[model samples]
Structure formats: structure tokens, C-alpha cells
Target: MSESLKNKTVRGVGWSFVDNIASSGVTFLVGLVLARLLTPAEYGIMAMIAIFIAVSNSIVDSGFSNALIRKVRVERVDYNTVFYFNLAVSVLLYVLLFLASPSISVFFKEPELVKVTRVIGSVLVINALAIIPRTVFVRDVNFKTQTKVSLISSVSSGAVGIVMALSGMGVWSLVGQQLSRQSLNSLFLWVYCKWKPSLEFSIESFRELFGFGSKLLLSGLLSTVYQNVYYIIIGRFYSSSLLGQYTRAEQFNMIFSSNLTSVVQRVSYPVLSSIQEDPKRLREAYRKVIKTTMLITFACMLGLAAVAKPLIVILIGEKWLPSVYFLQIICFSGMLYPLHAINLNILQVKGRSDLFLKLEVIKRIIAIAPILIGVFYGIEYMLWGSVFTAFISYFLNSHYSARLIDYPTMDQMKDILPTFFISSIVAFFMWCVSLFDISAYILLPMQLSLGILLAFIIYEKLRLPEYLEVRQLVCSLLHRKNKLDNKQIWTKN
Candidate 1:
């Protein structure tokens, strides 16, 4: 990699982490408050409509932002075309959702969904207005601006959600949160981003971009549908309260798993795309990314699982305790998400969205078995079944990576298994400590310290490269921060 690209990647990674951590942290704190203020069934109500919102959002993008990012020579008309296309699609979809809200309510046997759907469905259009700005920032690898946007949005919306929840708004507080967050996020992106679309729409640009993006659209649609299919099944076949428990588990798992994966995926995609032509550089970079991703993702996901019980009890109260088992199993499944995401990103970097779509089709087909398990057996079996599917999907996702970049499954596993092994040991130790008859306040801290201490010892002894890299990154960041602080103090004086 060139020195410039290396520096950009490093800076992008730092800001991306800050963006996700700060934004997700605020969102999480708000969720904790709302979870306490609300009932399980209330969360379930929001989860029930989450599928529609997710699918609509996916369709709104239709993978165009990715296409725009992947395109090396993006034109002004291209941005304008995609902006109009996305906004138009979002509007159409919202209308469809508005019309279909009644049926959605009927299917779930929850009459409240009709109004919630219309209100939250507006976010699709609101989000569309900011897609171009967000995409522009991402393509430029400008996550610093994004961090500012996300912090402001999350803080503002979280305050709104908390106030509403405290006002005893029930499930509507969740709806209010979603609306406020998206609206603020879109508004801030416009404020920070200077890109304004012109009145030009180019069919040539549309066709060119869509040629690459359409396959991703299909793949994204499949992925989105299946991802939320669990909510659909649980909402339809099971009770809303149970679905709420399931949603809580998934949310907790996502806080670490999805956010970490996203931070890596967002920055890695643009960086990897830039070097896609150089086979040797690409493969080496790919290896480092997979290892580093697993190193962090495995420890966090498994550690969260280890402290799942006490964490849930202390943070959201004891009523959410049922989510503990579901969270543990889901964390195992979530741990593999980075591997899955990175592999897919490789295909996109290679301009193999056709292959990407095929993989999604196959994986979603296989994913159906888990949905059946949830429908017939239970949610636990469903979550376990998901773990099995995640492993299978990893192999499937890696197939093209091995073919394209020579980083085969065995090689990848050999690289990541050490981290996984160490993480599992720490988790097991924490879980054992958690089983003791102790207060959650003490037990949570004890398990956390023990997990960290064990991981530090293992990594210090092994002298793993990924660990060393992370250590260096943390120290470098802190040193730079301290220097800036000192400089600011001197300037003031």
C-alpha cells in the first residue's frame, strides 16, 4: 500500500471507530433507559415493524451508494442521478408501506402497528434525502465529519426518546426515537456536507451504475428480508413479548458484533477497492483485515456473552433476564459476522456483485431452515440453528475470496482460530465466575476484570501480531490525543 493510502486507512479506521462507538454508545444508553421504562411487549411492537423499515431502507439504497463508492470515476451527474433515484424510490416505498400498514397490523394481530408504520415509514424518505451526502463522505473516507454528525444525531435523538419514554409514551417512544434519530441524522449530514444535486439525471449514468448495483440490490433485498425474517416469524407465530425478548438479545449482540464489523467494513471497503488491482497487496491487506477483525470481534462478542446475565439484569432490570440465553447463543453467531462481511466486501471490490447475489441466494435458502426451527421448535433452537447457518455462510462467503485472492478457507481459519481460541478461554473463565452465587453488581465487575486480565495474559504470552497492532494503535491514538490537548493548553496560555 502507498503511504498516503495507509495513512488514510488508519485515520479512517480511527474516526470510524469513534463514530460507531460514540453514536452506538449514546443509542445504547437510551435503549437501556427505554427498556426499563417500557414493557417487553412494547419493544416487541417496534420489532414487529422493524422488518418493513429495514426492507424499505434497503430498497431505497438499492446498492447505489456502494456502486457509487466502487466507481473510480464518479461524475456529478452520477451523484445527481442516484440522489433522485433513491429519493423517488424511498417515496414510492413509503407510500406502499403506508397502504400496506393495515395488512401488517392485521397479520401481526396488533392494531397499533397501523399508525406506527405510517409514522416510522416517513423515515425512509427522510433518510433518502441524506444518502448522497453520507455516500460522498464515505467514498472520500472522511469519517471525521461523520463522527460529528453521528454524535450530534445520537445525542439529540436519544434525549427525545428518553423524554418521551419518561412521559409514559409506551411503544410510541421507540417510534419517536427512530423518527428523531433519522431526521436529525439526515439534517446534520446536509449541514456538514456541501454536495448539492443539480437538476440533471443521466440515463447513461443510471444504467451504468445500476448494471453493477442491481445485482447488489437483489442480494441486499434477500439479505435484509432474511435478516429480519426472524422478527416476522416471532411476531406472527409467537407472542410480541417473546419477540421483544428476542429483539433485545439481537440488539445487544449487534451493539458489538455489527458495529465492529461495520467500522471495519466501511473503511476497509474503500481502502481495499483502491488496491484491488494489485494482487499481492490486496491479499496481504485482506489477511491483516480478517485477522484484526476477528481479534477484536471475537473478544468483544464472547465477552459480552460471558457477562450476558448480569449485564442484562443490572442495566435493563431483571425482567429482561429471559434474553440472556438468547443473547449468549446469538453472540456466538454474531462473532462470525465480520468474516462474512469482509468476504462479501472482497467480491464487491472485485466487482463480482453477480457472484455476490448468487451467494446471497444460496445462503438465504439455507437460512430458511433456521426460520423453520423457530416456527416449529422454539426461539432457542432457532438461534442455535442460526449459529450453524453463520458457519456455513462463512464458508460460502469465503469461496470467492479464496478463488480471487488465494486466501483460502484453511489459511483464513488458521489465522483467526488463535484469537478465537484465546477469546473462548477468557469467556469460559468469565462464565464460570458468573455462575457463583454473588450479587450482579460485584459479579459483573469481577467477570469483566477477570476476562480482561485473562485476555491480557494470553495475548502477552502469545505475542500475537494482531494484539500488538491493536496495542500500538491504542497507544498511538492516546499519545496523539495528549499532544493535541497539551498544544491547546499552551495556545490558551
Candidate 2:
């Protein structure tokens, strides 16, 4: 409610937007370069280890970092406790990852993983060192500094990746890029924020934070496990090349969804935490967030799904053509990832993590495991697995959250139905266009503009008042597109 906090919130949102643009842009560029340079098979090997590494890393933080953020009564010493706790976990993870690397290689029948996993696995320590500084920065909403640090680190990592890929380092190029980014981020954070821990641990402080943290940790672990289980299952049964293709397709499709949702998640958590007490006001904010998220998130995923073939061909080259269906399938499913994430965070903020835990267990079974079975059946089945699991998980999470927030499943569905109908029509129409070989330089924009314009027209025609408010929101944004559009203009006179 104070002026300082309001400024901090605004700064956090701005920082998130900038960080998403800079980091996602850099990642997109470097990823394109790597995709061009490395074979899908090589990327697949990395994907396999990524599954292991991601799950392990998620467990390292679980949800405690968020718990630290949301906890209202945190003491100054609580910061160090969370830091030490994360540090201990990171060290233990490194040892475990190193020891387990041989078995991982043996299990996957890829002996190279023994070395590769251990090397990439060192990021656990780097990431752990980052937790406290990031936590403190986020706890206070110092997004401007965070964004600057992130931009530098992202650009640096991208440069590392490109050079490594050009030098024929293969998979290690990807590994090196990741390691450099994590190390640089830690260094930046340490320099940017003057918060160092004493050699101290407080059980009491830990206990205070743990109340909120246990829920976040459980939610985080389950969430991570669910997200990556497909890779694990696929890598176990399918060849690394196939996994690599699928991973690329999936990752490429995720650019908009992840960038947008991650921005909201990082920004919303602290914002929502600060406004947790008044259920009416909290619910209002939640409604707007959910609606806005639905509008962009579904449209993004749907657009990507409609153009999976061309997108894969254009961006990743003909070598990865096999991933077209995989991309299309996963793109549709990923739309719901953001909503599920935000809704789950509501439970996290309300201190009703018991609900979150139960939801996670069901979600893994309903959403994750079935997809693994889809791989068991056939690769074509992977697409269906994605669609089916998304429906089930979305409905389930929406239902669960509706109880607490009192916003029904239909309300959420109502917001996106326009997107659903518009996307379907565009997809059907685009299918007719795709029947021939139209050059993407012409087709991509034609389809994109058509889809967007059609959606806007339809939304205005039917939901004009609602769309007007959204337009106002956009115009009111501090960084408007018109400014950028005019930034590089020339005066012919």
C-alpha cells in the first residue's frame, strides 16, 4: 500500500517484461544457431540428461524459494537459512548426479552420459548459490537490476553457445552454454546485491519459512517431474535422435507460452503475496490475471499448432521435418501450462498447499503418465496423449481452484472460447492453404496476420466491450509499440 511498494511492483513488472524480451530473444537466436549446427540426435542426448538434471534441480529448490517469498513473518536470519538449506541440497545433488551418471548412461545405453551429465550437473551448485540473492531481490521487487543482470548473462551464454557449436563441440556446446549462463548469473547477482550469508543456520528461522515452503517445494517437485516425465519415458524407449527431434519441436513451440507465462508467474507471485489477505481484492486480481493469461496463452499455442509444419521447416530446417506433428500436438497442450501454474500459485499463496499436494499427485497420473504410455503405444500417439492430458488437467485444476477462488471452470472457458473458435476456423482455412507449397516468407505472415486480425475482429464484434478494456490496458502500458515503431524512422525531407 505504500509508495515504495507500489514503485517496487511496477519495477518488477517492467523488469519481467524486459527480461522476457531480452532473454527470450537471445535464447531464440542461439537456439536457432544450435539447431542449425547440431543434429537432432545430439540434442536428444542432451534432452535425456536434461530430464534427469531438471527433475533433480527442481527437487533442490522444491518450492521453498517461493515459500520464502510468500512468508509474511520472515526474519532477517530466515534468508540465510533458506540459503544454507538450498546450498546443502545443491552439494548433495552434485555428488548424487556424479555417482549416478554411470547408471544413467547404462540405463539409457548412452555411455557418454557418464561424462556429460556430471559436467552439466555442476550447474546445480551454481544455481543453488543464486537462490538467496534471487530470493532477496525478488522479495523486494528489484526487477530493473535483475533484468540488466539477466540480459547480460543471457547474451553471454548465447555467445558461448554459438562459438561452441561453430567449433564442432556437439552436445558439449549446449552443456557449456548452460554452465556459463548459471555461473555468470550467480556472479552478477552477488555483485548486484550486497547480501552475503554468515556461516549460520537457524532451525527456528527455517521452521518459520518451512510452513509456507513445504507446500511450494512439493508443488514444484511434482510440477517439474510432470513436465519432464515425457522426456524420461521417451528417452528410455525411443532413440536419442527421436527424443531430440521431439524436444526441439516442443521447445520451439514453447517460446511464446513460456516467455509470457514465466513473466506472469515471476511477477504475479510476489504481487499476489503482498495482496493475499483481502479475498475479494485478491480474487479480482486473480480473475484479471487468469483472463489476460488465457487470452494470450491460448492464442499463442493455437497459432503455433496451426503452423507446426511450416514453422519446423522454416526455423529448424528440413532435417527436423519429422517433428511437425509432435510440435503441433505439444503446442496445444502447452497453452494450459501457464494457467495451471498461476492457479496452483493461488493455492500456494493462500497457504492451502495441502490442496496443491493432492492436485500434484493426481496431475502427474492424469497428465504425465498417460503421455508416457502414448510413447509406448506409438509416436503418433504422443500427439493424442498431449491433447487428452491437457483437457483433463485443465478441467481438474480449474475445478480445484474454482472452489477457493469461486471462479467456475466455465468462467475460465468463457474467456478463451473466442480464441478457441477463431483458432479452429483459421486452422481449417490454413489447412486448405497448406495443401500447396506456398513459400513461408509469404505464407507465415499472411496466416499470422489473418489469424490475429480475424480474432480481433471476431472478439470486437461479439465481445466489444471486453475487448475495449483490453485495448485500453495495452495503450496504457508504459512501453507501447508505437514508440518502438517510430524509434528507427527516417525523415525523407
Candidate 3:
């Protein structure tokens, strides 16, 4: 990579890390408190509408944000056109959701969701208003501004949610929390992002962008629906309390899997897009990204699985113990999430949304087995099926990377398996520790600390390439910060 591109990648990774870490940390903490205060059925009611909201939000953007990001150059008219288009689509979807809310309640058998869906579905419009600005920031690889916006919104909305829960608002507390967070996020994005839409909308611009984006639209819809289909199945087939347990388990797994995937995907997509023309550079950059992403992902996911029992019981109380089994099973599947994401990102950055859509269609077709497993057998069997599908999807996604970048699936697995093996050993050791006859309060922290320390020691001893690279990256960042601090002091003197 060129020095300029490398610098942008480094800075983008730094701020994206800050954004996910701070924002997710606050959100996780607030959720723990809410879990303590609210019942599992309440969370299940909230979970029932997640798919609708996600699908609607996906339609609102209609893949235009990605199209804009991938384009070599964007015009003001393009932004205006996408903004107006998204706004109109969001309004239309909101109305449809509002009218369909009762049916959604009937499907879930949760009459409470009739009101909840209408209230929470409004985030589609609220989030649509911010899509263009957020996309612009992402295209520029400007995550520093995003870090500020996310942090403020996360902290502010968390405060409001906790207060509402304290006031005994029940499920409305979750409703209020979702509305406040998205509203604050949009407000802050507009405040920080100075771009405003013009009255002019260009059909030409829309056509140009949408031509590249339409396949992505279908691809995104397929992926979104299947991703949230578990929620749908659980809410429809299982009790609300059981679905609530699954939601909590899924959240724990997401803290590591989804957050890390988002950070890497957001930073890598724009960076890779900028260098898409240089196949050698793109391959090199992508290889590094996948390795580093998997290094963290494997360690976090397996480690979380190892500690799932004590962590859930301690954080949310014994009432949520059922979530422990769910979380452990889900973590096995979650470990592969970043690998799946990075492989697909190659197709996106290469402007092969046709292939991307094809992949999604194939994956969703295979996903039916898991859905059936849940419906027929049980939720645990469904999760085990998810683990099965995840590995299959990884192979399918990596097959394209071989054709596109000459990085074969086996080679990619070879690069990542060392870290996975090391992480598995560490996790096994931690699980052994958990077998001790001790209080969970003692066991949780001990397992966490020892697991981390052992992993570090083994990685250092093995001199693993990804581990050393991450260490060097951290050192370079610290060295850069110290120089800036010294420069400031020298100027003051």
C-alpha cells in the first residue's frame, strides 16, 4: 500500500476501534442494568420487531450509501438525490409498518408489540435522515467524527433508558431508549457533518448509482432477513421469555462478533475500495485484514464461550442462567462472522455485487435447514445448525476471494487456524478453571484474567505473525501519541 493509503487505514482503524469499543461498552452496560430491572418477556417483545426494523432500514438506504462510497467521485447532486430518495422510501416504509403492526403482533402472539412496533419502527425514518452524512464520513475514512457522535449518543441514550426503567416504564423503556439513541445519533451526525441537501434531485445520478447498487440492495435484503430470521422463528414458535433468553445470549455474542466485524468491515471497505485497481496491493491488504480480524475474533469469541456461565449469572442474575447455554453455542458460530464478512467485502469492493447477491441467495437457501432445525427440533439444535452453516458459508465466501484475488480458501484458513488453535487451547484451559469448586464471583474474573494472560504469553512465545503485527501497531500508535505530547510541551516551554 502507498504511504498515504496506509496512513488513512491506520487512522481509520484507530477511530473505528474507539467508536465500537466506547459505544458498545456503554450500550452493553446499560443493557445489563435494564436486564436487571426488566423482565425477559419485555425484552422478547422488543426482539419481535427487530427484523421488521432491520429490513425497513435496509430498504430505506437501498444500498445507495455503499454505492456512493464505492464510486470514484461523487457529486453534490448525488448526495441530494440519495437523501431525498431515502427520505421518501423511509416515510413510505414507516406507513406500511404502522399499518402492518397489528398483523406483526398477531404473528408473534404479543399484542403489546402492536404499539411497540409502531413506536420503534420510527427509527427507520430517523436513521434514514443520517445515512447520507454517515456514508460521506465513511467514504472519506473519517471515523474520528463518528467516534464523537456515537459516544455522545450512546451515553445520552443509556442514561435515558436507565431512568425510564427505574421509573417502571416496562417495555416502553426499551422503546424510549431505541428512539432516543437513533434520534440523538442522527441529530449529532447532522451537527458534525456540514453537508446539507439541495432541492435539486437528479434522475441521472440516481440511475448511475442505483445501477451499481441494485444488486447490493437485493443482496443486503437477503442477508438482513436471514440474519434476523432467528428472532422471527423464536418469537413465533417459542415463548416470549425464551426468545428473551435468546436475545440476551445473542447480545453477549454480538459484543465481540458483531462489533469487531463492524469495525473491520467499515474501515476495510473504504480503504480497499480506494486501492481496488491494484490487484497485488488489494490482495496484500485484504490478507492482512482477514488475519488480524480473525486473531481478535477467535480469541474473544472462544474466551466468551468459556466464561459464558459465570458471566451471565453474575451480570444479569440467576434468572438469566438459561442464556448461558445459548450464548456458548452461539459463540462457536460467531467466531466465523468476521471471516464471512471480510470475504464478502472483497466482492463488494470489486464491484461484483452480482456475485454478492448470488452468494447471499445461495447462503439463504442453505439457511433454511437451520430454520427448520429450530422449528422441528429445538432452539439448541437450531444454533448447532447455525454453526454448521457458518463453516459452509465461510468456504463459499472464500471461494470467490480465490477467483478474485488468488487467495484460496485453504490458504486463508491456514493463515487463521494458528490463532484459532491457540485461542481454543486457552479457552479449554479456562474451562478447566471453571470446573473448580469456587464462587462464580471468584471464578469469572480468574478465568478472564488467566485466559488473557495465557493467550498473550503463548502468542508471544510462538512469535505469531498476526500477534506481532498487532503489537507493533499498538506500539506505533503509542509512539506517535508520545511525540505529539512532547511537541505540545516543547511549544509551551
Candidate 2 residue pairs that clash: 62-217, 63-216, 63-217
Question: What's the CA error at residue 89 for candidate 1, in Å?
Answer: 0.8
TM-score of each: 0.99, 0.92, 0.98
Rank the models by TM-score, top first.
Answer: 1, 3, 2
Task: Kindly report which residue stretches of model 3 are placed more than 4 angstroms away from their true locations once superposed.
Answer: 483-493
lDDT of 2: 0.79
- TM-score-superior candidate, 1 or 3: 1
> For model 3, which pairs clash?
none
Residues 1-493 of candidate 2 have per-residue lDDT tens digits of 4456545555566678788777776778789889999998888889888777787777778667887888776666877888888888889989998999999999889988999998999999898889888888888777777788888988999999989999999999999888998899899999988788887789987776776667667767777777777777778888899988888877776687778788788888888888888778778778767776677776778778777777777877999998888887777778878887888778777778888888878877776556755666876676677678778878887888888878788987886676566667766665566666788666777777777777877777776444664565555454544665567564332
Q: Candidate 3, residues 412-453: lDDT per residue as tens digits?
A: 989999999999999999999999999999999999999989
TM-score, prediction 1: 0.99
Clashes of each: 0, 3, 0
